[model samples]
Target: MLLPNSKRILLKLSGEVLMGEQQFGINQETVAELAREVKAAKDTGLEICLVIGGGNIFRGMAGAAKGMDRAQADYMGMLATVMNALAMQNALENLGVHTRVQSAIQMDAVCEPVIRRRAERHMEKGRIVIFAAGVGAPYFTTDSGAALRAAEMQCGALLKGTSVDGVYDSDPKKNPDAKRFDTVTYDKVLADNLKVMDASAVALCRDNEIPIVVFSIREKGNLARVLAGEGVQTIVQGNK
Candidate 1:
């Protein structure tokens, strides 16, 4: 069962997850499975908001590093995220889960612009709101956008669904002996450069006293398992 204070959560998913086994672009079957998981979580009566990254399509920093204009690359990256948000929206709706896509960089024809009160109303009506376009600015990541929306929506927790199960002392893929943390302080995560999230995202959650739950999304049924506090995960919170 979730703590009494954790009725609402903001979920952040990397775009790569949408690719599934493919090297690039959205994989329909994978997204359907993810949508089912999300619907299952919502069925537990939790208000959910989502932020999806665009790394599978394009990354502003990667483009900038390859000689493109940084701001232009970032705008392109933002567009990529919008595409991903639409894809997820379709998948969720196919599962009979109502969802709304609100873009920071609004294209009114496709989706609504980010309006805090409107978003809250949507969730109140049992509709999930997916935030797209990171911060509406260059040099910012979707992680920061997720944190910002999580704060704006006053979500009790930010659930980061990644490939790894939890935050580790080192890169678990490279260091087979790396230790996973069951719980860790915000300061320790930042000081150790744990890579659980960008520094800004972590700091924002820390400042707001919102706990960040890190867990693997690829595993079947893990989202609900973690939400029920019965799965392997790392909880990042303030020092007691």
Candidate 2:
């Protein structure tokens, strides 16, 4: 089955997903499993794009506590995303998924620079374009960068694959009584202070009319299920 009303989707996966059960670093098995799910989604005829976070390897804010400059740490974090992107590229290609890694910052020897037209061409050709490096700047999370890319790529929706199934009234793990929403309006998310994405990212999605599908990546094949509207997820889009 196809993702109803969606021809293209931008998937935002955190670096931690690549780490599997490990404390840090890429886990080969996890990446392979994720690639399979992505391939399934692709098989549904959706042109896919990826925007991966770098928290598994490094978080600029965390590095700053270790006496590293914020910009320096952020640059390091950006590089970490590229590493994750490279790992994903390898995994997807191994499965014959046909993938390309495009970094926001130009590093031609390592990967292609973020070129809008070229990226669009890749997607049209059914190649998964993995976007990395977080806007190629500091003081911004990959969430915002992902939103930007989703808008630029003209994707139908932004699928945020996280550890939790959906946006909750409170931290679900911390509060057993927390309520989960099947869907939420942009205003409700901001007014209720829901932890979907950062303010800038959420705002970008709202302004661009791009729906954000928040679902757990930990569940086996949940990404494909969510797209088919058969999995637990929260859709943050328009209206109250």
lDDT of 1 by residue, 1-78 (tens): 654597788999999999999999999999899999999999999999999999989999999999999999999999
Could you tell me the lDDT of residue 91 within candidate 2?
94
Estimate the TM-score of every prediction: 0.98, 0.97
What lDDT score is found at residue 97 in candidate 1? 94
- For this target, which candidate reaches the highest lDDT against the unseen true structure? 1
TM-score of candidate 1 to 2 decimals: 0.98
- Predictions in order: lDDT: 0.94, 0.93
lDDT of 2: 0.93
